[model samples]
Target: MNIQDLRYFHELVNLKSYTKTAEKFGVSQPTITAAVKRLENKLGTTFLIRDQSHKSIIITRVGMQFDEHVQSILNELRIAEEEIKQNESATIPFGLPPIIGRNYFPTLVPTLLDKGILHRLNVIENGSYDLYHLLLDGHINFSMLGLTKVNPEPGIRLKIIKHYPMNIIVSKKHPLAHKKAISFKEIANENFIGLSSDYIHTRALDRMLKQSKISINTIYRSPDVMVVKSLVAQNLGISYLTTLSITKHDDVVSIPLLDANQPEFILAAATRENHIMTAKEEELWDILTK
Candidate 1:
């Protein structure tokens, strides 16, 4: 049966009068009767008891049990409609790692705004670790960040959007600047600038170096990606960052760190495990993938 059929049956159950139920919708009593009949035929079960001689109407014992379930479905439908409207009108809050947000949001957000899918956007800049938890906890709608080798929590889901090559960023004056490529072993003595220790990228780099018994000097650290880049540009140290994090700067150059199969920086979108893409989220995904 259709929504109209369910609506008729719902109202009829509460009113216990087909005529009054039809009156509520400004429809004929026979229309209500036929709607309920259609619903019963579709479900193969009677939902009401009618007294032909006295014109009395009563809900069936089975109807009472099914009414609870029908009411739940109706309530959920109503809630979904309201949420859709709110999603269109309200500012939707989502998250992104600092570098990804900086590199991608300018184009992505405007594209969505131009399409009229999003009214306003709220972005949270965070490390991948925190961003994943935010999604699992339902703190943000969705986020773009890196996922290391470690699997995330049970209720968090990720989809890889793109891969960026991890680059060694250094000042033009630095001796390594002219090199075609560098390896972790060769940079053992170089000072390093990095994302904060809590960031997954930083930790991953730490693990990589530790495995080789090599430790570079970590001279500077910050949660802001710009700071890390700026430090490298000033020759304070070299830093490992994805190509997406690079901006046009005269003082610095990004050179690839060579490895087999071309290791890459992965960027992904995270959402609640089973989040169904509503209009806004679906539009965001489209722009991201394109």
Candidate 2:
């Protein structure tokens, strides 16, 4: 019925032995047994059945179902604790992916600095895929996520702010460098340097390949955009990247994809569903979205 009883029961189910559960919780075996009995009596169900030897326990059907609820309850409690502590700190937990941080975030920096909220931001830099998970887990208050498409997810809200085209990047000396635009079919045989699967760029690339009915020979994969660009610049292999990561100073050419239905790198502002924005958070969000 209580949190401790649930914790003990959950651990007992996992460990499959009362003595082991007691050892894990640093409690006497009787205490663990008592907790389990209390839960069964409150719920009016036999969660587990112990054999005569008592070496192992068999979890009843109800026990398995109760464990699922216990996990959800525990997880929610933990997230609530984290959210409370974070709110007390008065620092906004912001998520910023690397590509957007480099190309787009600067435009809003002046506004944030003028409003005196720049120092209050706790920026967590990661790939957009990872950032989305962080937002879902309540680890971050908000994020600018790079996505291939806006899909519905539970406990999360997404709004598309901008869209950037994905392009084929090549070294200046590469054969396709002179071409302004190229289709996926034209480079089907080319050696590709792709971003890691954790990136939306990789997802876009996979979709393109599937649509074009062609497979590419990927020579290497990197999570860092800089490393991918460096390899492409060396003519090691061509790469598919979003224009957001490309700059005028980079020694590479961004050739637009000529595919009729090319996928775009989507920039979306995401936050937890029904999240109430604090005053400072609202100010910062307005600046970011503006």
Candidate 3:
């Protein structure tokens, strides 16, 4: 079957109107009708049936099933086109989440500069959740993803760089700050500050709470880690964060959770499984994986 026929048929299924599909594709109504007929003939099944007035159509069960495949096919083609374009471009589209970019990514910059690939980077900074989707959709070439756990996805390759324990952070003056470690039960009813849902910390926090059967009052949420740290430093509320974000310069104390099985914050480098890296991209990937 012709590729154009697949496009026409896909849109026809979505719009459910021959005139609208034809208008959208800038083709005649007969062309749309012929495309559908060609696909049905090739498949050896009746995909659709038009009413006597030819003004409406009823998609057969086979048609719906085929439409699902068509959607996947079209999406793959779109990603293929984007990947080809990315290969042709001189600059690499790199994704970095804010937390990783701020705390972890700087460690790689010196090596990147030494390798002379730093100038070729076109960075897209966002939360890990958004960066993961962007990399999967072919909007970015590679991403340094921060996640609560290793989530396996088809057509994506992930290399675990490091794992840091998620820790509880509180102001120096807080009652629990002097403790070496604490359990979720000790602070279950305390006021809490938390990162926004976009961050992986939120997922780890939620899972910890659920597993421990504990709940706390979250007084504030911020996408900025600094804001969360500031709130915690002022003794307004306690927060959870990864160890990578903690430093001697910060006023807050990082205390480990005493849970038997605490979730870890994972740092990973992600790229499309099918992507053929250019020489420069390969060098960058090597440095990252190292």
Maximum-TM-score candidate: 3
Q: How many clashes in each structure?
A: 0, 0, 0
TM-score of 1: 0.65
lDDT of 1 by residue, 1-290 (tens): 58888888888899988889988999999999898888788889988989888898889988888788888778657645644664676755677777776786677766877878556567777777887766655556678877555366676676777777777889988999999888767889998888886576786686668766788888778888877777788888988877887877536888887754434678787666655676667787777666
Every candidate's lDDT: 0.76, 0.88, 0.91
Off by over 4 Å in 3: none
Give the residue spans of candidate 1 off by over 4 A: 1-89, 150-152, 260-263
Which pairs of residues clash in candidate 2, taking residues 3 or more apart in a chain or in different chains? Answer: none
lDDT of 1 at 3: 85
Q: Given candidate 1, what's the lDDT at residue 71? A: 86
Evaluated at residue 155, the lDDT of candidate 1 is: 64
Best by lDDT: 3
Report the lDDT tens digits of candidate 2 across residue range 1-290: 69988899888889898888999989999999898899899989999999868577899999999999998888777777777877899888999998998888988889899998899989999989899988888888889889887785988887788899999999999999999788889888899999888888888888899999999999899988999999999999999999989999899999998788888998888888856788888897777676
When 1 and 3 are scored with TM-score, the better candidate is 3
Q: Per-residue lDDT tens digits of candidate 3, residues 1-290?
A: 69899999999988889989999999999999999999998889998888768689899999999999998898889888887887777889999988889898899999999999999999999988999999888888899998877876898899999999999999999999999999988888889999999888898888899999999999999999998898899999999999998888889999998897788989999999988899999999999899
Error of 3 at 255 (Å): 0.5
